[model samples]
Target: MSTFEFKKNIHLIKILNLKATNINELIEGLKKIPLNSVYYHTHRFLKQHQSISPEPPNDFAYWIEKALNMKKLSEIVASVNIVEFNKLWELKNKYIEVIKKNTIPYERKKKCNKNEEFVFMGCKTFIIPTGDTASNLPEFYEKLKIIESSSIYFHIFESRLRIDSQINDFQLWLNENSYSAVAEEIGKIDPYNMTVENLRRKILNIIEKHL
Candidate 1:
């Protein structure tokens, strides 16, 4: 059996030099921006406000509603359940579809003021080992408690997008190790609905219950 080596990621955010003052430009930027930019904008809120409620609308939804004053369209875009998306492109497409499907052709070109332009941004992600390794369930549970919240975020949120898999690192490792029942419990957790600290506690409780 192989040990699960824990890892964490650091992101260096950069301006994509893309800005949108209207719905049409926003859609064009969405289609033209790098996948990393899409990922950053979508998940930026989650990563930055780990202690806050996870219901904060994503950057696009926030800007669209606030700047463009497209409350209904913004709500529709925000309502796209990001948890269901395993890939960045999938998430991007959903946003594009929601916007296009909801708006009339003339409405698509409606513009916001110059001050309220939506600026596109991206990040360079660097993954590194945390020097934490677990060979079995007991060790896994113990490490889960002490690891940084970012590590929890990485394993649960970022890993799926990175690997282009529907399941997360913890669940994948657990299932591979014949802990399918435990993995199933983990799969039921909605990481988007709670603080990362809460997520960590929930995961620990799940693992402890089975121990």
Candidate 2:
């Protein structure tokens, strides 16, 4: 059999209401819609409501309520021929699991770093000569390259000079080239003084020099 001929069974499309309770039964009902119609409807739905959270319903009743609010459900039902809705249901369940597991870790990391303070420094701009020498450096060099290329001024005072030569080179280059470099270093503070708004402002000021 030809490759195309080997695939005889085509899945139908089904647009479900976010609040459907009997999801398994609903998936069965969608087996009549075409795959192409389902794909198009799903794309349109996502484009229109990109901000909707991917969380699963707490109960069947909740699913029913969500499904009712889906504006494109009818369009999906009419256009697509769905062979199986089980895969879609499984996919959504997996997404919810991932979100739940990741959310806590992300929030914890942000919270733990709340008391951290960093200084604003003048930015550096230089094209790295690409060759074998560049390839052997640590991954941190790639991050530095991105920061240098995009930033106009860096938060200098917040940064500790790990290498004396680097500090000297920066001072010499700025003076010799006559490029403006502005920086302010804030002293380290306790967690009580690390307000979120202040941190945001400091970061914005650093970014503004680059633009």
Which predicted model would earn the best TM-score? Answer: 1
lDDT by residue for model 1 over 1-211, one digit each (tens)?
Answer: 5689999988999998889988899889999999889888888777767654544568999998888888998888878988899889988988898998999989888888878899999989999999999999999999989998889888998889878998999999999999999999999988887778889999999999999
Q: Residue-wise lDDT of candidate 2 within 1-211, one digit each (tens)?
A: 1110000111233433321123333333234333333233333222223234542212222222344332233233322322122244333333234323333433312211222211111122232332212111132223233343112121221111212222322233333433334222212221112232343345345435543
Point out where model 1 deviates above 4 Å: 51-55
Clashing pairs in 1: none
Q: What's the TM-score of each model vs. the native? A: 0.94, 0.18
lDDT of 2: 0.28
Cα RMSD, model 2: 23.1
lDDT of each: 0.88, 0.28
Candidate 2, 86: how far from true, in Å? 17
Highest-scoring model, lDDT? 1
